[model samples]
Target: MTEQNRLKQIIEAALLAAGKPLSLDEMIGLFAESEQPEKKRLREVLAELTEDYDGRGIEVTEVGSGFRIQVRAEFSPWVSKLWVERPPKYSRALLETLALIAYRQPITRGEIEDIRGVSVSTNIIKTLTEREWVRVVGHRDVPGKPALYATTKEFLDYFNLKSLNELPTLAEIRDLDSINRELELQDPDKVSDEQPDGDAKAAEGGEEDPETQQDGDDAIPTDEIDTESTVKESEAEAEPEVFAESSDETDSFDHLDSAETPSAEDDTSDQQIDVDTEPMDDAEQPETEPPAVALSDEEQTPLKTEIDE
Candidate 1:
């Protein structure tokens, strides 16, 4: 092969074998001192290789880290099938936190929390750092001296981005839902919060969102428990008052009957005593008289003579 073609072949082999991005300096270092090509010639070779890969399943990509060979995005679906293991899923919180770092570099944790309106978890920061997607650029000049974060070249490389300029503008984002769908991250938190695309389409056709169903499943029981407790409490409170009032009324009626009975007995006994002591008219006298009545006849005759006088 010609020397120029050999140089191109060498560069291509270096990129494919590296398994990661390589800068011009790194590529040049692979050659001997006498054989190293100039930076301009290297860039020209890289550009020519990029053109050659235009219609292929794989392409030469330039990322923030430098250049690398990667499968074109269109072929990833079929290519990914080669691996049985699925990609690791990240949480929506983690994704959003990463997004903030990428979009607003040199931002502090407190600043991210302020924009998100929720506190960022330490685990999420640790995860991003561990992945080498983010790093502490510097500390803010404040009392607490919070670390300012920025996106690393690994972040750009993973996302297949050339630079921060390649990111979609805020207006172009539309919503996180669309972005998440495009990324196909399938974050568990996002999945829990949003209905599936099929369910969403079904909802548009008059079915309910699955998320609402899940919420109902969780929320309805709580409402029912509260309602049942309130009803039972009200019933319990009403029952005692009803029983107490009935008992009080019954006791009052018994007291009234007892008091009236003694008064009635006393009145009847006084009436009998009055009848025994008062004199009885002749018409009211007994038809049969006792023997004592004859002894009293002489006394009665004097009493009768005095009555006639």
Candidate 2:
């Protein structure tokens, strides 16, 4: 059989076996013939097959785990018209949260909380997340490490919006005063230079404030110790004079005081040990001359010395 025909038969059998949407990867694994099967061609074939079934009683939708051939939702009204049972209605909080997300996309939970004036319900988010309508787009570089959530492409399909920009403006969002607008003000995509853990490289080797830099990835170390002895030694050499000269309360360099540094006593001990071994290091060190003449005042008075001379 031709590749297309064989693939059609394979997909038809896979559909029968899966009884649900089959993912692109799943199909590739099943029909991947040789080393690196032609995935692009396969995708094209799948698209063609999906198009072939478009006008029929069924539709192909990418949902949950994979793509599936399911009855057209547009026909749900005609099919279920007799029974007339409505789909479950979402609660007010869920709808409000969804609307906020749908309108001001890529928003963080803290922003949502701020707008709602109440702590966000995890279950509301969980339900939206489970529905696959909302997804983590990015995070805010803020104190709490809040995740930025946005409506997905499936959200667009479900809500019948073409794109995020097509959503009604905040000025028009039904009777809810705009707060997520501020939430949308912070865009992770715009701040692409920052780290996932919120580590941002400041201008001229300056450090980004920790409060302003992290989004709370638990795998990252919250505090990084300067383990290099050189750093401690340099700070030890610098601190007394550094503090004496600076009076700025805002200076973060004051962190040097909190950090462990080599003290003067430690340096004195090191110097005493070094002095005992200075002879060995003489080649590497400057040499000093020993005293050659000694004066004894009792040996000769000034008048007696003059007469004798």
Candidate topping lDDT: 1
lDDT (tens digit, per residue) of candidate 1 on 195-293 = 687677776867544565555345566577799999999999999999999999999999999887677779899899999899999999889965564
- Candidate 1 lDDT at 52 equals 96
Quote each prediction's TM-score. Answer: 0.57, 0.43
Off by over 4 Å in 2: 16-20, 32-36, 61-66, 78-86, 116-119, 129-139, 151-309
**lDDT per residue (tens digit) for residues 115-197 in model 2:** 77787899999999999989998878888778999988677656545567677655454355344344353344434644543
List where candidate 1 sits over 4 angstroms from the true fold. Answer: 177-309
User: How high a TM-score does candidate 2 get?
Assistant: 0.43
Where is the poorest 10-residue window by lDDT in model 2? 177-186
TM-score of 1: 0.57
Worst 10 residues of 1 by lDDT: 177-186
